[model samples]
Target: MKNVGVDGSTTLKVYESRGGYVAARKALAMDTNAVVEEVKKANLRGRGGAGFPAGVKWGFLPKDRTTTLLCVNADESEPPTFCNRVLMEHDPHQLIEGTIIAAYATRSQVAYIYMRGEFHEQFHVLQKAIDEAYEAGYLGKKVLGTDYALECYIHRGAGAYVCGEETGLIESLEGKRGQPRIKPPFPAIEGLFRRPTVVNNVETLSCLPHIMERGADWFTGIGPPHSAGPKLFCVSGPVNKPGCYEAAMDITVRELIERDDMGGGMLSGRKVKAVFPGGLSMGVLTVDELDMKMDFEDPRNYSLLGLGTAAAVVVDDATDIRLVLRNVARFYGTESCGQCTQCREGTSWMQRIAQRIESGAGRMEDLDLLLETARNMGMMPGLSICGLSDGATYPIETIVKKFRPELEAAIRSQPAGQVEAVLQAAN
Candidate 1:
């Protein structure tokens, strides 16, 4: 209840009443290195799906560095995930305070928040919060009478999911096509305008203020030892309460779905058929695995599904697996930036096959072809420019592997009624 984004509106008054800027005040009083040390002790990991440690990332920047940049990735284009908008809309100052602390720790003077173009309301709210902070002396030169000077800017992206990637974001910020740059000159070492930059997610940076205020031990005590701190799980589809719930990381999907405080089970008294634990990128889980723990490690341990974005999408018994695959394939095919041959051609191929199969034009051999294309497209370890290729392949691979019987059945059934059922269930 304390950290719920929907509880209080995201405004200067509401934020101040909830002790919003107190962390910024406390941070300004401490040595910058001490703040970095405290964050390191907290073992805070990136919430941007990569799970990189925030403090370690800060430490990677060169000492006595000037002109360093802190870029916040607010492009929450991952399909089933929408928690970042809540944070930006309901609690903008927390992000501001966290940004200032991170900038100070890295000795950066400028920060940019790269938000998704679709988030017009969130952008307006965050822009207003930034204006309020500058007027209130929380941002700009001589903040709270301290020598630290920080300036934050907001940049809206053009609805590209690839922009959620750090290098792609940097490229977009530079007014170029959002293609990912190669690593080894990692973003921490050489990033944004070729200067040492720290690109963090909106949720990742927002937690910094709380970590500083509550101390590392307090944060670590909230969740499981490995995945410390509270996580915001965005549940959608067929659930009685389809919204975001902020709880400890160790909470199980079964508990979340069944509890009145969370998802509260499937809607219309329908039984769950499948669940996508971490958005579509994490593949899918059949009904038997619904009890899997909603942690960073549990999915892999239980179902071999990687925890990609923490977006829980429930699919009830009335759902059709083939239609789900085709819809997801279409999304990836359309969203592919066409930067790489593997992604561009492979996504198109997968989409076509899924469509053909749905239209009853598919041969029994088409299923094998679909699996082959996905496998050869570098779904694992990623051969494309960004993670889009891998993300597309995940659902296809899982559907064919785990739900093969369903696909085969759809292929055998009469095209009119059965295919209609598949398409209808997709909606």
Candidate 2:
């Protein structure tokens, strides 16, 4: 619940002075099962898009498992989602401590922070924090004079968006291309050098310290049932304030954008055309749906995919919807690892269609084709390798679905006499 790095609290000495590693000490003293149970009671969901229960994820590891690895997913490459980056740069020790607690709960001795390579400053900040932790006996050989031991290391990713996926991250950590692996043996049972591994988001791990300190009941009581604990939201686009803000999961999208403490409303007094309520993958929401709650159950009410990373990228009335769609298409298209032909091919096609549509070269049937293509890419009928395709599918599908009228209007309004001008501009 506390923001550590906002006021120059990055140093180990500062972190320790504010009772940073106390939870690790507490976790080390308790039985690992007890720690896991406490986290389960807190109802802390993963902050990394999926929102899976972190405690449940920890429970997936087999009892008495040897050579387990805990990987902290610091690959904050998702567009407009900079909450993790802010946390890492400002309070590196918090993540380090959280990593230690997670490793202890999972009974793992070796932990890796899979950070994005572009986070050059945050990478060094975390590395120095790890070094400080090691020097202070908070990490390495024996954590805080306890028998529990953990060696935390920083594994820099090559800025591949696929590496944000756990298996892909594990593969890249092993010096392979950042493509996802087929699941049957989920990462908890088989991962990271073919041994048991547990991957958790940086924010997910960061929540442990608070959960351990405040107790599960306290943490769970903070938000609505399932959506318990404080959530960090990254709000970008044409807002008066574009930054990471924290609030309970029950907060509505309108409040997040309109509240003075949050986004402080849209800039230039423009009406919102659509908002990617929880980053791009969650799909776009109309201005009328701004009152929708951001909780897991509430998003479905507004026809959203789900709460993905809880990062909102607002698009105001002045911005073109096609441009937004094209941008989303381009990101997924460029990031697809090509492991599955469905995602690899579908994303490219979506990009082409979206670009063509945006450039006034689209036909009336293009919308249906785009929707059909997105649907096919979303679910592979066992052909798709990972969620990348699905991730790519939702935004395009939802944007097209929700803003059909706008797109249609744009197409109809295209000047027939300016075909050459349009073509030249597109080129």
Candidate 3:
């Protein structure tokens, strides 16, 4: 991300002038296992929501697998997340070089960059870079004069948020409806036309070029031991400088929101009521808890889902918590693929409950109702096919749990009949 605007042009020539593709050349010279080992040693966790180790994911491929496919997830559908888009739009060749290296490491002859259909500008920029790579022989029949060959293509998605899921993206790329497939036969084992496929996020693949340049040890030394490397964070909502910034995980939630170089404090006298530490899906953090570190494991310590995309959305104190909950619930409800019974019903149920609460007719028991409904919908209960329901639940659950007093007060302020109905229901 730091290299985003370093060069004047997005073309391959300018990228090469800055020593781009050197990593690809270096990675191609190493044995496949050796390249994978270097990544493993770096402990490069995926910048995508899950925070899974990238090298470990690659190692999951079967040893005897003959035909492998690499899917680069450029579908940046997660709300408040645009770091991946910025990478592809400004420094496309960096992502291309990284993709070439990733294909080589996985021994894949074909790679598909599944981009969001809405990224019209980014599409042309990345495609231009691809054309440049082919012209320079960095990709295609023979990559950089090496025996290894790779064909990379940009396949735009129809803007379905579910396609951000690996199997859902595979389904969309396969010309089917973009719904998630059941696990156990994870993409690594049987994927994309039933061949072993490696599904990596755009930002995750973009890290490879850097790793290949600086050895794994150099990469690991930047951040914590378990999760090491520079991370691109997106800070949005009411902040002075609401944009993307790069740093190691050592930066805290407060620093991300208040640091001069980052969000630069809330916009002119607006106090933070709450902030979504790792995007809306990761659950809310109270202003008091802003000091918590924005790292993979630290978020769990603070009861968040995970580090997520590191895309923080700030909610000002003047905003109603009920409205925030309603907004988040509505998004997940509308986006649900309606496949799993739990997710289908759970999301709608929670959304309706949230809307009622926001509109001042909710029962006091609805708070618990929302939480109970969420509990049964996600992978945690082994009910849903993917994490969409899980994402829907976190914000609502956390909002209701952390801001109960405010919601209860709202319920109390209603008309006598409503208050009595709430008290009677509670009894």
Model 3: lowest-lDDT 10 consecutive positions: 418-427
Clashing pairs in 3: none
Deviation (Å) of 288 in candidate 2: 1.0
Q: Over 4 Å off in model 1, which ranges? A: 1-8, 302-305, 379-382, 415-427
Model 1 alpha-carbon miss at residue 157, Å: 0.7
What does the lDDT read for residue 126 in candidate 3? Answer: 91
Ranking by lDDT: 3, 2, 1
Tens digit per residue, CA lDDT, model 1, 1-427? 2344445556667778878778888988889889989988888888888678899998998875667998999999888998888788778888888898888888888999999999998888899999998998888998767998888999999988888989999999999988888776888889999999999998888888899888999998888887888888889999999888888888878777768999998899999888888888778888788778877778886544466678888888897787788888998898888888988999998998888787665567878998899888875664766777888888888878888888888778755466556556656
**How many backbone clashes does every candidate have?**
1, 0, 0
Q: Which of the numbered candidates is closest to the native, going by highest lDDT?
A: 3
Model 2 lDDT tens row, 4-62:
53566888888878888988888889998999999999989999988999999999888
Name the TM-score of candidate 2: 0.96
CA lDDT of each prediction against the hidden true structure: 0.84, 0.88, 0.89
Distance from true position, residue 40, model 3, in Å?
Answer: 0.5
Q: List the lowest-lDDT window of 10 residues for candidate 2.
A: 1-10
